[model samples]
Target: MTNSENSSGSILQWLGFRGARGGRSVDGKPAFANGAGNVFQQARRHLLDEIAAFLLTYELDVTPNNLLTAHGAFSGSNPALARKIAQHVTAGLAVTQEWLDEITAADETIDKHDGIQHLMARLETTLESFSKNANDTRSATADYTDELEQHVAELDQVQGTGQILSSLADLAKAMLERTRKLETDMRRSEEEAKALRRSLEKARREAEIDHMTGLPNRRAFEAVLEREYRDARASFDPLTVAFCDIDHFKRINDTHGHDAGDRVIRLIAEMLATISDDNCHVARHGGEEFVMLFRGISLSEAHKKLDGLREQMAERRLRNRKTDEPLGQITFSAGIADVFDFSDPRAALKAADEALYTAKQGGRNQVIIAPKGGAQAA
Candidate 1:
């Protein structure tokens, strides 16, 4: 038998099912096979059925990327990868739910930011008014003091008690009016300062969140990473960082449109959030990429977690709801490195990037751990 025929037979034998050979169905569809055919023909039919089932179940488009991703997930030796694929396939639903929550929170934050910006502007205007009024009050007070001193001096030289008393009363009334105006300005200024303090707090929160994914943005991530790195070094604690990138993300954008691409980004972000815990921090490193920080975890532990996540990502079949077309499987490659192994944070990130490069080169949907020493500059 030919290699194809031999392979077919082996697969059929492994499945414990015979192949069908004799009949044609009325619809011109080959009669459903019930175990009778040449090994090659049976194998081809079985493969076709499996492919159809996969497409139907996942609502995936019959694209080359989807085919390859599905084949890897179904038959790959690593069970973790397969399970991960399954997780990815199911991630779309989870993404939808998680996105709603994030969008709601995001909307609330945006509103607060808007409100604070308005308040800050008003406070700025009020403070300016207060500054002007305080200057005016000081000048008025100086003029009033001079007038009172001159009136008293005049009163001492004059012969009438009524004139001196009248001047004294007028001076007292003028000083009391100036004191009340100053007090009002001071109170208004104090309230404006309080509002400004609140606005600053809101501004800080707005700065830290990524507008697209609602995850911590790179700037915030860097601050947290630096602090953690410093603490880990001092205490000799386990700290690991992973760099992750989506496979064929540009192709997805080109093929499915930008809206679909956005969905993919949000999906991945939600997935990361779902998998993370209090000890694990997740951030969007930028377009189609992410970074994860695992505190109190060694390189091996981080590797295991990321590998599973990678597998899950591979299994996810992204689709465009508008066209009802499968966008194809979403897969990622990742690299993990121990923080303490590197001399600095940048070096650690570089090593993780190199390991990620290796993973992508090896295959588009796996994880690789960075070498112990560190990664060389690319």
Candidate 2:
């Protein structure tokens, strides 16, 4: 057989049809074979044209190009169909190259295009019917390319969404951590403030209290006296001062040790504190002496209060447990002076002291009142 005959047979076999041979005509050419070959060629041309038209309408560029090259040499004596297919294939290729160029030049435009699946569906139907002899190959290739591109685009979209979610999670975590730290700092500051307040309160208490007897000390007494003095000056209210000394306190300390003497002093301080009212303030002045400030009271009233306190002290017995003996029954000499006659605390105190001296001379355990504008008398 000639190469042309072999090639024709190959094309028929590719289309799944049998090539036929017939007896020679009177002109010595194969007469019946030529007619059959013409019929087969026409059918092939019809199928190619349908496929090419579909590819052009739907923009399947790559599969048509492959089909054109595969069947170009065998599509004989029908150069018109071959040229038509070639033109369509070229057009699709040009369109594809332009599309790729457009995508590269302006990526934002691609985002606005129909999604991958929609674009691929149009392409698949067009490219898959390009060759009647190899329809299965063309269809399979189009389907594979379409599905693959769609999968890739979907994966890209998923990845983009994942990135956005990750960034939001990071931002939320950062805000939570910041809020936690702020709360921790506030708690720490609150605790520090409470500690500082407690320290300040303790210091103020220490400043106001006497260390030895646990009563108001001389400084606190003076503060109260000054306030009472101002109020009396303004309202013309009566104010009085009483100075009292423990009788023979030095002898008591010399007889019983100083420890017993301290105990005796503490006992006397407790008794005085109990006997005094809110209008009166009692304080340990020094050594064995104590001072009382009275507001809105008379000299006669002061005399009665001091006398009662003295009798109470004399009746109480203080004894040392170690010695198992009486430390002593305590007694005090008291002097009262009116603040109306004195301009300052010192003058009042001096007047009261003179009265106390008289009381001591007259015999201890007594109340002495300074006669208005006169010396103190027991």
Candidate 3:
């Protein structure tokens, strides 16, 4: 018998189905007896009914190989039937592989990266037109002023007729009124333009900053780190990084609920922003963690600044809103490392993480410094 048939037959036997020709009845009928045929027929019928139910429910495609494998695995206990099922499974997998290849090829034909460039070019053109319009508006206002002045000079030089002088005065007043309306319209237009520009800038800034903390997010932090690293390399200025982790953050969440946890995070974020220098860029790395980049500062200096911030945080008295009782103080563990020695921002972060792990291991509320090329402290 073929391998596929053998596999299917074994599967059928394992599933408690008897073969058609070799079935020995449980009532002690001879192996090759005609009475065994009746039992095998009943088993085959039941098995086929199950296969039909499965196919109907699953809505499987009625391929010849699938049908044969399904039939053999359900009713036949022969080794050859089992082998056929295995071969059919392999063929089915090959078909799926071909389908995936076709889909991927079709996708690759249409996928391109030119849309972003086109959009940027279009934005630039729009900005240029806006600028030109502004210049044109300014020139038009100046030209109108010059014409009004010429009109005034003409009025002064006119013949001594009171009616003509009065008529000219009325015409000049109407012209001035029209000019004032135009100026008001122009101011409104300029205000709209300024509003649009501010909206775009606000969107860009929001994209780089964390929504909850109002600090730089991970993407912005990475960009700033690269910039700082380049600056440090060129000027040989000291650059340090501090990896800060809030202590027992999970415990706080479990004990006081996520609302309290969020409040604590926001409070810490505000305190960090207030304590850090303007040059220092603080970012919410992710979930109860923060990163601080100190430009032109030594590791010791960074540690001192972080230490003070930690103390300030620990001293703050946060209370339960309903009970008026203390909710317990929040503390953070920090790790400090120099940015100059690390090859990449991630490496510097890893150094700081190592130090943070050390701090956590030692106790939970202390700062640990990872030196340039030394073992982590405990």
Candidate 3 lDDT by residue in tens digits, 246-312: 9999988887788888988998899888855656989999999999999877888888998888888
Off by over 4 Å in 1: 1-171, 375-378
**What order do you get sorting by TM-score, best first?**
1, 2, 3
Single out the weakest 10-residue window by summed lDDT for candidate 1: 14-23
For residues 19-71, write the lDDT of model 1, one tens digit per residue: 22223344433454655478688756656554455555545567775565445
How many pairs of residues in model 1 come into backbone collision? 13
For residues 294-350, could you state the per-residue lDDT of candidate 2 as single tens digits?
A: 877887887888889899989988787668788767899988899888768778878
Question: What alpha-carbon RMSD in Å does predicted model 2 have with respect to the real structure?
Answer: 20.7
Candidate 2: global Cα-lDDT?
0.69
Give the TM-score (vs. native) of candidate 2.
Answer: 0.51
Better of 2 and 3 by lDDT: 3
Model 3 alpha-carbon miss at residue 200, Å:
3.1
RMSD of each: 54.9, 20.7, 42.7
